[model samples]
Target: MYRLLAVDDDPAVCRALFDYFSSRGFFVATALSAGEALRLSQTPPPFDCAVVDVLLPDQSGLKLCQAIKETGAAVVFLSALGSEDDRVQGFLSGGDDYLCKPYSLAELEQRVLARIRARQGTRAQQVLRFGPVCIRLDRRQVEVEGRPLELTCSEFDILVFLAQHRDAPYTQDAIYRAIWNQPGLDGTHTVQVHVAQLRKKLAAALPEHSLIQTVWGKGYRFSPPPTA
Candidate 1:
């Protein structure tokens, strides 16, 4: 089932979304604020899409949309402000679609479904394969020899970043900043710890292969297997 997160401070709107999407066979999760929306996003089985209101009590939905995009979920903005500049700002914030307030729920549903379908359609091109290991970008899932591999959100993001770059090396600070979406905060130790844990897990899964390689004085690199 496609999972969705709806973030709107209006209780009526939240309830309507929950009810409408639920009836349409979607697993809907609603949050009344950006903080709540972020908290809900941390849960496993990440959301496939998020519907966010432009204005929120805690923070702007544009900021929240950027964070949601980090989870690899499509975002659609809902707003009462329908000006061209407002729509442009929404798209700049990584929103896939925008709907003006007083909108039809049916049309909203179609827009959301269309974005989900588009993401799924691109899944084939987004997948990463290295021998028995496979990474599905659309679903944010990793498998080894057809067995599902459980990983934390950070670990998965780190792996995806490195795997996409293939043989290119990345410093620990670079990886940390990229994955955490933060700048200048000393993440070397934290990155090392996560990379260590990730390496241990990968090693345990594939004893004969080393996918994440330590680049001596540099940092780390994803070295695909020779047969890959």
Candidate 2:
């Protein structure tokens, strides 16, 4: 069964969503604020999709969406702010879809399912192998030489992104935007830091092969050994 999280400050809306989705076979959870949603997100078996309101009691839902994206869950923003800029900001903050308030619960369900389906489609190749490194998309796992390699969510995402586009050099700004789904407002320093950490981990596992290559004047690329 698909796991769904619905976040809205209105108890009525939350109850409605819970009832609507639950009746349709979704395992639904509801939260009234961003903090509560974050707390619930920590539970095992991560949610497949989150329906979040743009305006939250404690924090902006855009920020919440970023945090949820790091967990590899699809996010849909539901808001009364229906302007173009609002929708743009939602997408920039890693939201997979944006729906205006007073939305049809049916439409919301369709949007949520669509986003989850899109994500699943992208991960259709369940396992990706690059020499001694193996990525299991379904399980969100990485193994090096048949031994499990622990990687933070961001690191695993970066690895998969690079591996999918093997040999193509992407600038730090590009990589940051691709992974975070936001413009590099504070520069690409965060991407640099994550890449550095990821490289260090991979180096420790594969001493001889350099799977990720940094291109001077460019950015980075996944260049596994040819024999793999």
Candidate 3:
């Protein structure tokens, strides 16, 4: 059975999907508001897929979708507003599928299942493997020599940013803005520091592998050396 999170303000909607999905071999969890949905996501063994109503009492479902997608969860937006722009915005907000209200619960189940399979396929692609080091973005797991390796919050976020944009150049200011969420605000040479710390950790883990490449004049790139 797959884990499912269903969020909607209407009690009937939430209970209906919850009961239906649960009957369809799914362990479903229902939340009346976006805040409840987020709280549920914080626990271990993250939800494989989330069915969220666009109109929530607390927060926007699209925002929840974006937040959970960063952790590798598939999102399906459920809303009454069915327009071209609404659907487009849902997709742009990281929703895998958008379903209009007055829709079939059976169809929602199928869409959720399809999203789960799609997420499985996409997760493999998001992983970064360099020799014995493996970074699983979906799970936020960093492994060395097939074992989990603990990393600082800053180190993990920065490393993932570089890997996702491999072969690209990013100055300290850009990285700071991306990781620190301080857009257009530059401070000290912080990128220089965390990069070195990441390098040191990598060196200690995989002595034979070179994962990060320094582009002189530019910032840096994540280029894992080819295996011999």
| Candidate number with greatest TM-score | 1
> For model 2, where is the 10-residue window of minimal lDDT?
178-187
The TM-score that candidate 2 achieves is 0.55
Query: Which one wins by lDDT: 1 or 2?
Result: 1
Residue pairs clashing, model 2: none
Off-target runs (Cα >4 Å) in candidate 3 are: 122-228
lDDT of each: 0.86, 0.84, 0.79
Model 1 per-residue lDDT tens digits across residues 114-201 = 8887876755546889889999876889998899999997899888878866656888876765566344689999999999999999
Q: Local error of candidate 2 at 128, Å?
A: 16
Q: Please report the candidate that would top lDDT against the real structure.
A: 1
The TM-score obtained by model 3 is: 0.54
On the 0 to 100 scale, the lDDT of residue 39 in model 3 is: 81
Query: How high is each candidate's TM-score?
Result: 0.55, 0.55, 0.54
Worst 10 residues of 1 by lDDT: 175-184
Better of 1 and 3 by TM-score: 1
Give the candidate order by descending TM-score. Answer: 1, 2, 3
